[model samples]
Target: MGMVLVSHSQARVRTHDKCAPLLPLPMMLQRNVLSDSAPILLSILLLFQNLTISSNQSDGSDGEVLLKFKASLDNPAALDTWAGPTAPCSGWKGVLCGQGRVWGLQLEGMGLHGAIDVETLAQLPGLRSLSFKNNDFEGALPNLTRHRSLKTVYLSNNKFSGEISDWAFSGMNSLKKLHLENNKFSGTIPATLTTAPRLIELALQDNVFEGEIPNFEQEGLKNFNVSNNRLVGQIPRSLSRLDASSFSGNDDLCGEPLEACPANYDGPTKYDYHDDRIRHHKFPETTIAVVAILLGAALIALLGVCIFLICRKKKSHQETAPAATAAAAAAPATEDLNQMERGGESAAPGGSEGGKPSVRLLTFLKEDSEKFDMQELLRASAEVLGGGVFGSTYKAGLNGKKMVVKRFKHMNQVSKEEFNEHMRRLGRMSHRNVQPIVAFYYKKEEKLLVTAFAENVSLAARLHGNQMSDHQSLDWTTRLKIVKGVAKGLLYLHNELPSLTPAHGHLKASNVLLDAAFTPLLTDYGLIPIINKEQAEESMVAYKSPEYKETGKLTKKTDVWCFGYLILEILTRKDSGVEQQADVDLATWVETAVANESSGYVAGAAVFDQEMAGGRHSQVEMMKLLRIGLSCCEADVEKRPEMKDVAEKVEEIKEREFDDDFYSSYASESDMLSSRGLSEDFRSINI
Candidate 1:
């Protein structure tokens, strides 16, 4: 039920391909035999069965392996897209198909907290590569011998445990590269792994493997690392070509890479042996037991007392360490403190035993809760709001006050000091659309951040087809207001604030919440550092500026690009259809589409044709925005526009209006927009 990717080769099928004839007739027949809901259920089950059967019937498919993958996680209903037209493999979420078969399965950071179904994945005889990086998958990796065609396997940064078995990878003879880094794997490296004749790279670093390092004699093994483990014994001369840093962390290791093994110490047999016999007689067993019991009891009591005293001292220090200052000046410092503390918690370095790092919990008191819990707020409107990239949200009433209660999925990666400092900063901020932290509850593993609930839904929700209402259609005026509101929020993040802190690296339509007046309020305004990587990935995947991948740093320029994308979302009335592009090669499509749009060939094309199509957004305006977006999505971080310039250009376009004349003659008719780059939008007369 988790993330199970299966490959089945058919007569070739494209992204826009239609479904085969056999699958739908059963649904047609079921209409008479089952009730309304029953038919839906039956259809879902039938579709899964057909997919299983079809996959099994294939010469290259391994059904049992696929079944094991399906059993390793929660429901994988998100992957079921087989029915009316497109088969699931062609357009399913987290699937990549090429030449009528599943080529890769990249479910990286999908909040998929379950064990991997290695068996299921191995069934796809044609799978060239697979990656489940930065997820919450646990347990030992499954055997994958049948998938001899796999070129790469990236299972890094997971919770996978157990010793690396010889059979675990002995079957994958064709694997060119393997990444098992940053896991809890132990035991000695299997000598059989060295037998992979075609393996080019093997990364088994950042684990708990011990014992001697094996000499992987394969000449083709160009990149191999067994670093940061308890490995001992001498390194063979065959691996002398590798950098010494690769074998640095281990202590007991010796030889040329390290030093010569310690000389075998021979006892001074004649004198020492005679002196040992003259030593005092051994103590009685009863005396030893009595003394040991007394010492153990004393140590336990002393440890308890020390812990109690430490807690008391810590609590006392917190109370007297300076009272809360006014929100403006002190808020930035508080936010900074939170950031530093959170960063420390996240980067938990070594010193752990048993392969498990230690974790600390957080808690907040009710009596110490903030004053904004006004009841009338929720009384007027109370609804069960859903969860976001960070956590769940709910509409509430606080003494006639309406507010939003955001229940964050807390992790051991944040400390109490960080949470307190960040909350203080959030409390000081007072913006209309920007949700303020009204109250918070942090206890043990549970943490709840309460904010004033807004009247309107997220821009993404509004843009979604099923959720859009006639009256809610954002006309030109409302769209302008939305743009301005978002711009101002971003402006505050980039420049208006005393501290030049960038909004947690992402700003998509979903993060932009609307008030009753349709004013945009940026949520998660000051809570980025408190988020875990998995949670951050959920929020960032769509809105992430391209520079993030290269530098791994969040900057104001990144926010500007995100803001530009949000503007494009508003103008086009599209909810970043990033998730929908799971079937196609998104990187290729975006690049090609952006290029075509830039050159004016696809500039004012209808919404249906281009990915960013919709009558709500002006083609000329959308094209202009796309130009900005392409620049923002540029690989070079320094080349992107700043927020101030972005806001000004957007304001200018709104005033000038994007009409026919605006679309036709702005640039050359080349296949790609001239990489002419970005400039200041300082035209005195708007556009």
Candidate 2:
């Protein structure tokens, strides 16, 4: 007799006559139909014929399993794709087929109902995974021990009830992930789960399981949860390594990660009190009466003293009323004289001065300018720089040093603590491109932030301000440098300050100032958390991103959108006109220009600043930047590139420009040397 081995691909079979004695008798009999004994040979032939027939009908068996499973569904409408032929491998929804047989079925959230036909499904010899999660399936989970091929099973978010006995997962050595959460299963979680040596993830949350949690700590296990159960006793020491969230809602569960169990306490117990051991005592009535009379006399004397003090305070106020009025009237004149000597205008009436409690200036930075206090800040020569949605900014000069003070208008909602916290966080940030806050003053009625004055000008002024004869128009190199600096600054804010939501929520050209060397300095960073939403919207309306109206929340993506507009403003040297009656947004205008140029109807140079275009600049490079800007302003927030990515791309562009210039210079030098050599050769030939 010969032996036959079936290959994994069931389509192939091989026979080895020499190995006949090595195989079992039944296997040998089945493979060798021409055995020495006629009876044995005949029996083996009959069995082989039956196996051939079964192999040919296995697809039909799989189709039957699918049809039965579909029938068990309460809502046929949910399985619309399960209609037509029962050829699951070809057209069935959620059916995965391999090696000419069904291997996986996922019917998640398909409105399935009734118990799954585990016995019928087990008939599919190749089925390896099953998912019925997020459905209406109910009833006790059937025995899955027969389905040894299953590797993953998800039965979560259902109404499967009853105790999952120790034998439920018996012999399932190949199972890897099992999700049984959000069910009605009760009783202790079976310690038998440790039998599955390959099991990795087990989720049993939101069940009615009680009793002490079983210790099934296996080296291969990675994720496990039994939260929202009635389990008692200390958590297994091995399982304490998992997150506390995994064991939460289990009231009686205690130990290591959780509260330690009481040393002398067993589980819950009842106590009985004996009434026979009780005793009572009484005090003398005359002693209590004497104490009450003494207390009444003390209260009468205290009341008389309080009344006399009230009359004396009223008389004192009456005498001071006229004097206070005269002082209040004369205070304005003194304030004017002080303002004149300080080389600045008078502080606004009803400001942080005028009979208010003096506040101390809080400085987060350790700069020399921190020496000035609240009196110096109030007395500093002040002139209104401008007023925006948040409030007005003032250019204040104290002694010889100059600074800018931003006084918030409608920030009454922000408490003093929150304001100080925001200022401290901002001051801690140290970046070349970010403007540092020197000091801040917070009061109930007023809040002011002081920062060093940017000596050059703002990006807005450089681009759109009235160009004086002495002022040089920002060249292409300077503009590119400014954009790169702003992007790098934003990237720092985004990465270094994760706690600050919507990092640089109000980024705009006006907020970007230029230093003496024309380096871009970003101001007003991280102000969104403390400012009023309505005021933020009203002031930053011009730079409001596309998602602002829809989400009504500021996000880092919105800041990216504002950065995109800032790029457009710098390149086109035009404002978005959101603050005016102009209907065209800067981004929209640039997009239209790019579209026309891409269509070959207009030169790409049309979208660039005329001063830059008139100079030697790459129109191709300008178009590339325009494309980037458009991507940042995309209506979809998710599509916008992160600030880090933006910074990298801008850096690449900057490097490319340097390469172009280097190559241009090299070519010019080569031409000059060649001409000189030719002239020398001509002179030698003439001689």
Candidate with top TM-score is 2
TM-score of each: 0.41, 0.49
Which stretches of candidate 2 lie above 4 Å from their native place? Answer: 1-322, 325-360, 367-369, 467-471, 541-543, 578-582, 598-603, 614-617, 655-687
| Worst 10-residue lDDT window, candidate 2 | 662-671
Question: How high a TM-score does candidate 1 get?
Answer: 0.41
Report the C-alpha lDDT of model 2 over 531-564, residue by residue, as the tens digit: 7777777776423566766876666667777787
Global lDDT scores for all candidate models = 0.58, 0.69
For model 1 the local lDDT of residue 69 reads 61
**Residue 166, candidate 2: how far off, in angstroms?**
51
- Estimate the overall C-alpha local distance difference test score of candidate 1: 0.58
Off by over 4 Å in 1: 1-382, 468-471, 496-501, 538-544, 577-602, 605-623, 655-687
